[model samples]
Target: MFAVWGLIVLAGIFVVIRFTGLIDHMLPAGDPPNFTFAPETPVPQARNFFIACPPGRSPRTDRAMPSPSFDATAATLADVMIETAPAHGMQLMSGVPGGKPGRLYFLARTPVFHFPDWVEVEFILPEQGGDITFCLFAQSVYGLDDIQQNEKRTRAWLADIVGRMGPSG
Candidate 1:
């Protein structure tokens, strides 16, 4: 009887801990993010490598810093990313139908937990045939604490982009 009681208590504790986090990942983090422009949304930003993710959590944000830039047309860059993302093990979840020219907003699953993470990429076409600025935003579906997996995944994919696309900026 005591053993059974102990197991029930443990299970109850586990379920309770899972739901009590103040933030829920299913809700929008803020205004729909715009990747091509500087933050017009209220998504958290990192200051001097410190992010105020929450009032108490330490890692702050899962977003990458100094949004990467590329020297390619928005259409071309978006094509490159969509094609290459699967090779990097990011299974596509969803995106704009016909894939939104020169921009992409989609969700992918992490391998281990199949955790969902959102990534937005957009390119700003500079005048005079200048380099296009690649702005990217990624966040985990489980909110602020993704065990740093979100950041790691973003960096790895960005490096892959640089290697394959050879972004000039």
Candidate 2:
């Protein structure tokens, strides 16, 4: 069973590399402000992504409420996301233009393998003083399937963010 032993060794090596954070260097974080969130044509066909936009902002009309409406301002929501990211194993990525409101990029790694995933969030502030809405797009960097990890992580992060925002939010 040399092949079995060899496989075990390889798996161990990968685990080591992942825990050391060495795999992060090889992953692409993607260009910010370039990713399309929702209501955009030709979304990626990969199954390893999750997109959450407000009710009217997405093409999927079956979803009663795809994303939560925030009572806070975009700036406040951004602040909440920034504060909550690290706790969810995410780090903010650079390259967003300053003075441009409502766009944020983040890099997240899987808990075990450290596979990189890019997350983009766009806050939508209505002109008529309505609740703030947002779109979140999270995609894996090197996989055709992620077993719904992206959706789970996005939902958990959103819940934590809303919890932090309190009753009014």
lDDT of 1 by residue, 39-61 (tens): 33345542211111212222224
What's the C-alpha lDDT at position 50 in model 2?
Answer: 79
Candidate 1 least-lDDT 10 residues: 48-57
lDDT of 2 by residue, 25-119 (tens): 65655554345555644566667877788765664422223778778888888899999999888998745554235578888888876788888
Looking at model 1, how many pairs of residues clash?
Answer: 0
Error of 2 at 139 (Å): 0.9
Model 1 segments beyond 4 Å from truth? 1-40, 44-63, 92-102
Model 2 vs. true fold: TM? 0.81
Residue 87 miss distance in model 1 (angstroms): 2.6
